[model samples]
Target: MSTLTKQDTFQSLLDSASSSFAPIRTQAKETYLTQGLPALKEEEYKFTSIAKKLESKIQEFKSALPFAVSKEDIESVLFEGFDGDVLVFSNGKYLPELSTSPEGITVSSLSQAENTPLGSIAKPEKDAFSALNLASFSDGLFISVPKKQKVEKPILLISFNQANSGQVIQPRVWIEAGDFSEVTFIDHSISQTEDPYFVNKVVEIKGGLNSHVNYYRLQNESKNAIEVSNIHTDIFQDSRFTSVNLSLSGDMVRNNLTLNLLGSNSEGNMYGVYLLNGKTHVDNHTNVDHTIPHAESNELYKGILADQSRGVFNGKIFVRQDAQKTNAFQQNNNILLSEDAIVNTKPQLEIWADDVKCSHGCTVGQLDEEALFYLKARGIDKNTATGLLLYAFAGEVLEKIEEESFRSYAISLIQERLGSKF
Candidate 1:
């Protein structure tokens, strides 16, 4: 008898559940098997080990309702003092009773959207995780902003994992902004139970011509949890898209953000900050594709690793042959707070257009001792001084956020993670 590997076990589970969505399940399995695990040899995944950990942590992707959190329980999770269109999901199930959206903004479940004209945005893809999510997603949010309208309030989608029995949860969301429309979307993930589990989430965003969209993600799962999220966005002519990712907690985290500039004069900005402590591991992989002329993109990712934590950043920018006069810039910076902390930073640029302006750079270094001593000499404690310096280092990135309330909230969270009250 032959022994079955972890991949085989997961494949078997997928096969048994084929009746749910046979075609998607089959495609996902095939992609997983063919792609195997992205290794360091793969240029796009050179800084991260996604396949290795997925194989070890997930024996099989089991889907079962272990526990359900109530609407009232989810209401308390909202940003306490902020005003926004709130949508809450618990254990991958949407809790409509807890969601609120004023007039002019349309919000519904993916299942319902599948029956309407909005279904076009929910089409399944060949990517393994996205395929799996499309096949088995129980609940997700579908948000639409009408054309020529500006949403006064932000749209917040809060995903909660409250399973105490350690079950896998998948949450998906699709957002579409019409031409000349403007909106802000935020995705927040939290865990209520201490039991270990997996969170697989997918978000698809489409920005129409002359539209503007700002998306932010806060991944603050428990230390015992594992999280994998994929965000795919398409920006049209004269449209603008900005995505900010802040990862604070998780045993292992892998985030993939892909942005496609489909029209001329479109702009995309990607920024991320990951603060890791203990044995936590965080990896961020991003791609900016400039397929049209005169498009622009800028990416900046900064990380802080303490104790035995590890951080990885892989950013790639591609300017196609027809993308003349395209401008792209990328930078990855890291600060190791302890000797045991490890960081792998990689920034890459592939330009086939000679007229494009592209640049990419990465840096990994320790805290500045000279600056630390200068602060300590002024009667500041070592810990406090270090925390202040870390905050200053992160401030450069935080300043990029244009919204005051959101920026303040993010700064507070960063301060808390740094063990300071700044």
Candidate 2:
């Protein structure tokens, strides 16, 4: 009746979690309480002070739960003309009423799923945000694709954040693919909230033998939204895992993407594009590990910054001793349109294998004045010429997208985003 202390509130929240995953909850809670939130000193989080930011709005986050939602509110964030199968979440609560799944794919509530692979690849002990999501997520979705099945349509996961201006939302999703299955998954996040909000989201994927998984993530939150997202995937033997991340708009956003190639002949491809303007700041961090022989990985990320926006990209590749004949390549390129725009890029490689081919490089520079002038000299206007040149630089990553419909949608998004800038 008087007051709910922080410990009391946290305990109450944990006690109310689904008992099916109580052990995992207990472990995650321990990790969250022990390691606590990341600090600026940690090399992994030096650029992004997410822990400090989240701590400041902890109470506002507590009040975000039981967040009210209306039908019209969730519909606003749906991607235009893309109606395959959508699983919608408003403020981290799965809305089954507005969600749908294809034939070969099975989707269910996470809390009720039996023998769930909740914390398999993304262990809570490793990351503070992962620990918090595993500890506090009241509900989420668990999806599975059967062995030897091919899902013709891509699955859409829409994370829509609304109201609760200063609230914090944690969305957790677990996806598993059986041996020889093929599927594509897409993640789109948006905010209809006015004031700044925080989102700590984690999505873990487990790929099966000889499976193919294509994951595409789009970040286009509101002007004042802050988000930290982690996507960790484990690819099995003879599997192919490709991930494309597009960061368009956000106040401050950080993405931690990791791919573990634990089996032979497994391939991982990473492609990203970030277009920033105004005071927006976005960071993309990627790690790919090759632990077995005859595996390959390729990564490329491009960014175009205008106004006073800032961008950071760090890509790391590791080829272990046993990973003979591994092929790994990573590169990041950026273009600045204004004097105040800035980019920091670091591409690193650590190889312990004698017979591996590995290379990493990064470049940060302004637009090619010659190229812009060349186009302008011809009948093209200055603005159009500049936009064309910028698109050419970023379009290479967009062309890496295989799916036709999604590729087109992504291209349109880029055009729309750049149109406002140039």
Candidate 3:
């Protein structure tokens, strides 16, 4: 056995990747060869050295079938009181036997779908991770909602990684909402192993005229696992798009969310919360682009870091020259619970339109000592008082979740992380 260099690891992956993607994959490999993995020197990845992390886990990138997962494991993660349609993927392979076929929507494997919605809103050339997913993925999940159809029940996508030690999984998803269609989607990722592994996934969403799409993503990976997820969405005329990301725990996690308002009067809302502890690391990068006049976008992200954990946030809002009357706002806030905890936050706005209202800001600080003292004096113990204050600090974002059950689940996860009774 010998230590592998970064080039060797990447070459190995390219050598084993499928040629089914054709010229796209060919171009991606070429780009990767030139750009390689994102390094610390790259401005976009300055705070997080993903190349180093990927190199460390390079040996885990093996070709193996999905590891066995019991029904009990599925039951444990399901949302209570919800009987909606479900799609389960084990090690990035769709398991039909464990999924339910729901109506009002067309579902198909990407190989069988009439359209492969890639390189459109989610540009592979713009990012190496997206390019890697396009080049390496075997099959993908595709869902299409018909015009004027209201998906009464929420659609659930469970991406569970069950692989042996030192293995990797890549899952891809594409969702399309037809004109006037309405749907709610939940995307979740979990792992069953305590051993080191990696999961890389990409999600693309297209919203047609006047459509409404609500998307929520929850990442609760094993302590030894690493995950990189890129989600890109396009909003059309008069449509509405809202998405929230909750990153609970992982050895290393990176999330990239981009929303493009392509038509006038479209609306976009982006929110996220990351509660990290131990030696975990989480980074979130969000981009909201307004290309049309009269469009609007709002973004807010918060993080709670304890122990020696680290968090990073970079949000950018871009208003094109023709995007007059556009309204865009971005804000990021963080609380460092321990002296060792660290957070790097940057909120940026690039506005070429003079009439646009664009503002961006970020704040990094510790908990409110006066608030904690007040709570403690009100007959609450120090631990409980601290937990309550933290809960209140996160409530602003948690309250945005519309689903009661999901909201409760998110709150409970926060409480568990806080070590508070209640």
Q: Candidate 1 on 20-130: residue-level lDDT in tens?
A: 434554565554555444555666556555556655665555664535667667666666567777777778777787677656977888666754332133334434456
lDDT tens per residue, model 3, 273-305: 999999999999999989999999989899999
In order, candidate lDDTs are 0.78, 0.82, 0.83
So what's the TM-score on candidate 2? 0.92
Clashes of each: 0, 0, 0
Give the Cα RMSD of candidate 3. Answer: 2.3
lDDT of 2 by residue, 368-422 (tens): 8898788878988887777777778888999988777678788877876666243
TM-score of each: 0.90, 0.92, 0.96
Give the top-scoring candidate (lDDT).
3
Stretches > 4 Å off in candidate 3: 1-7
* Model 2: per-residue Cα lDDT at residue 5: 27
User: Ten-residue segment with the worst summed lDDT in candidate 3?
Assistant: 1-10
